[model samples]
Target: MPHDDFQLPEQPRPYVQPPLPPKRHGTGWWIYGFFAAWICLGALISNGWSINFMVITIVVTFVGTPLLGAALFAATKSDRR
Candidate 1:
């Protein structure tokens, strides 16, 4: 029999950390967007900075650039299989 003042301590469970979440990945589509915006700027310059065309050019630069980038990203993407 063990004395009341002398008892062994219980063993502690080992520390087990949970797994981390997966990282978000991306393809370099904005690189194409920069190229597209540059091309739009060139077009605006060649058109003598017309106001109406300037508006259209800007719309295309912002709106179309993203669309074009997404299209390229989708087209060239390969399956992980």
Candidate 2:
């Protein structure tokens, strides 16, 4: 094949930028702090450190925090619209 035999396409494919993530409402830190405080308060109240209290605190801190944060964020975002 000759060096100049092939012709380049006239139009090149457009470059596409990936979509950006949705902006946070900026309350994440506060929500986390609130949940941490709740856990600490629970510990303080449960001086004897019963198993049930410990389990409750663990569940609330780990599972409840994200659920509460999501609910709060959704509520705030919805209000903005």
Candidate 3:
């Protein structure tokens, strides 16, 4: 196409995403939170006396819960593209 021939089409426009969904409080959230805490507590009881057990449980609680929540959100989100 030549520059002289180029023109912008007059069309409604392409859609743009407004934004990521706002953080929501849903039953799913509570469930995940409870499950994470429960696992954390079990870990504490089962291995609280062991240095390795305590470290592993702390790591899982800190890193695992959010990763699980994000995965849940990603799975449930609508595809906009």
Per-residue lDDT tens digits for candidate 2, residues 1-81, read 554455444445344212212335366576868777977878887775798678878877888788887798888667645
Give the best candidate by lDDT. 2
- Among these predictions, the greatest TM-score belongs to 2
lDDT of 1 at 63: 80
What is the C-alpha lDDT profile of model 3 across 1-81, one tens digit per residue? 665455545434544434434333342675567566867686767765577766666677667767876776666564433
Q: Which of candidates 1 and 2 is the stronger one according to TM-score?
A: 2
Judging by lDDT, tell me the better candidate of 1 and 3: 3
Segments of candidate 2 deviating more than 4 angstroms = 1-25, 48-53
Q: Candidate 3, 68: how far from true, in Å?
A: 1.4
Any runs in candidate 3 off by more than 4 Å, and if so which?
A: 1-23, 31-48, 79-81
How much is the lDDT of residue 38 in candidate 3?
60
Residues 1-81, model 1: lDDT tens digits: 466435544544344222211211335646656766666675766676667666766676778777877786666543321
1 against 3, candidate with superior TM-score: 3
Q: How far is candidate 1 from the true structure (C-alpha RMSD, Å)?
A: 13.7
* Steric clash pairs (candidate 2): none
